[model samples]
Target chain A: MKLISVNDLSLQIEGYFAFKHVAFSLSQNEIIGINGDNGSGKTQLLEAIVSNKTPDSGTIDYTPGVRIGYLPQENPQVIEQSTGKYLEEMRRLSKKLAVRKDQLQAMITYMGLSPYLDTPVNQLSLGLKRQVDFLSAVAGHPNVLVLDEPFAFQSEKTIQRMLDLIIDLKNNNSGIILSATQFDKRIATNFDQLYLLDGDLKNIAAEQKNEPVSLLVFHVSPNSMAITPDVEDFLVSNQDNQIELEVPLKKRQIILNKMVQLNYQFEGMRKIEN
Target chain B: MKIRILLKSYLQLYFQNFLYLTMLFSIIAFELLANHLLEIGNLKKFSLLLIAMFILSLFSTMNLYYNDSRQNKYLKQKINSHWADWSSQLLVAVITNLFSSILIFIFSLLLRDNVLVDFVGILGLFSVGFLGSGIATLFQTQWYDHSTVGQIGVLLFIYLAFSGSVVNILTAVEWLLPPLSKIIMTLQVTSSITKLLPIVGQTLLYAMILFFISGLVYKKNRKNA
Candidate 1:
């Protein structure tokens, strides 16, 4: 069943169109990813879907009595209360939104935030704050989840746990909408559908029908240039000493061998389809 | 049910701020210093306390409004109504200010024995608090983007409410402001119900209108939040 449908959405920020002529639908047990750079209206589009923002022109229809859980990109200005207190208050006020107590408790333990329950949310590290916000949103066993940049400050282990939790929620028939600049292979591959938000919603799969490519990330010493993979590799990112390349499947093993021969440190590699 | 939870949460946060503690202590300290050190009569002391209460309540209410605006986007989504979110915080501000006003009233009574005047002081303080919260809501929600303009407007309103009578040129426009001056005057001059009712009623009516207008403004503007 369609959980929510947005038709011809147009949102303007400061008299400029954030995103216009956007259309999409989310269904039960489906996960949709919105990829966009900064200021591409990803946050604004998500906010409109979650009812935190109003679009200049469009209609967003949700299933009757459908409950929504949203994780905003930023924290509220003043978080004077302890994390535990805030979460408890949110739980107490769930009201029409049902709380998944056991699930939430388990998530807290899994995220390793048990010791910081008494700590003020404002005092928490960026990563921990994001975790707390995520848990608060997940407290309700909502029918739909609207997450904006959920993995921005998360550690790899915590990101994996969150992905596992997302999968679990999907198995329980929850529809999810996630917005991010880019998704790691583990996350992107799991997306049932993907849309690129660049002034409009464009289906990524429909735009590119090519097979998945292998992504190799490694750190090379400045002197090791015996066999560069530039001949058959598309560089995805090069930050710090590490480089991420989208190489053809046929050249994946050759590049790995060349890196091994050149004494380059292998960080990680995976197949990605975008 | 949700509003109650939100109110309780907001109150807990409201009392925990160092500013609130300072404000509370200052109220007591001012009452003490004014009653003990100053060789003024009960009427003058009572007047000073009322003015202090009005200023403190205005700033205190503004402080709460600031805190509420920070989380308003998140809370508005939770409650699914701008009216509920705005009102819950307003109630918190009013309740907190009322507590302090009552405390100051009791402290003054202990220092001096003017029961009738002190009782009228409580009503004046309540009106001050309601009007302050109304103005704070108006600024925080509707005029948030134009904060400088809003701040100037608030300063002008305060100036008019307190010294508008002295500035006789603005006499014709007194009706447009909260009936704070009238309430202060009526509180001091007479102790008769017949005399107090009309002024107090005017103050309450003005406050109610301000609150109603601010609420509508908030509901209208918060859509773009």
Candidate 2:
């Protein structure tokens, strides 16, 4: 059964179309991965799926009475309260939804959140905050789980445990929707379906495909509007504050040197084909 | 069940914050110190002083309701009911204010100052507390990060309230506000229970309307965010 279906969706941010006419669906026991570059509207699309964001135009139909759990990318504004109390609140809400969280306590211990349970959520490290959010989402045993960058800021062992828990949820017939910058081998191997959200959602093969390309992400000073270096040929996309360039593998070093010579602050460089 | 959980979370958050704890205790301290210094001789003066303290404390702590994107997003995703999170916070605000009123009433009772008059004063305190919190919630929900605008709105409300008495023309426009002036007038002009009942009803009615409007505005703003 289709747990959720988003059709002809359009979302605009800061008066620019983040994505237009996007469409997708999820079914029971299915796990879908949405891959995109930074600021490609991956998070926005996940939020829309969970009904946290309103689409500019479209319909996101959900199966009646299907409970959803969402993990936001950050929790800087979370209310000041002990982590234990926060988790207790989520547990109560889960009970209200009629979901049994028998293993949830054990999971909390396993995640190393036990010692800091009395600590305030805001005082916790960034990685721990994200784990708290992940646990909150899992406690509900939601019919649909929407996680944005769930694997971020975690150790190898923690990431493995999270992946195990997610797979277990899938075994129990929970559908999952998650977004990531890129799918590593482990992710590509486990994910049942993969969608590339460049400008719209497109179903891509599960395996990571390599192309002869590299991505150059750079930041320009907010006050400066002009790039002193002439690299229009390599420019893939440019926004007011950042620019992305698609460079050939052989020319990547030349482009980096030129940008460094011109004093442009390079944010990151990643191989497009990995 | 959802409301209870949300209410508990909000209250826990409020009580845990050092600033919120300071504001709440400061209200109590101010009541004790001011009562001793002013030598409140009657029920009316005592109640007025207590209610003024309540309003001040409420205004000071209401900034906690300023729009927080992260917390709002978390609640919006976790809670099933749309109004549960907002209504829960408003309930917490009212409950804390009520706590101050009850403490004041108990003190008045212990002092053995005309039980009937003290009861009436407590009733008046309830109405104003609701009115003040309602107006503040309306502004907070309607404006994102509403510190500046909320301050301006509060100043305007205070002006309209006091001006209604000094300037005869402003009395006609006073009815549109949360009936703070009316509550004060009723407590001051007549201790008659009948006159006070109608004012209580009017204040509660205005508060309910403001709450309803705040809910609507909250939903709209949440969607836009």
Chain A TM-score for predicted structure 1: 0.78
Tens digit per residue, CA lDDT, model 1, A8-121: 999898889999999999999999999988999999999889876779998999999788989999967456678887776666556545565665667788889889989998
Q: Which window of ten consecutive residues has the lowest lDDT sum in model 1 chain B?
A: B191-200
Clashing pairs in 1: none
Docking class of 2: acceptable
At residue B137, candidate 1 shows an lDDT of 59
lDDT of 1 at B8: 66
Give the range where candidate 2 chain B is weakest over 10 consecutive residues by summed lDDT.
B61-70
**Clash counts for the predictions, in order:** 0, 0
Chain A structural similarity (TM-score) per candidate?
0.78, 0.73
RMSD of each: 5.6, 9.4
The local lDDT score (0 to 100) that residue B127 gets in candidate 2 is 62
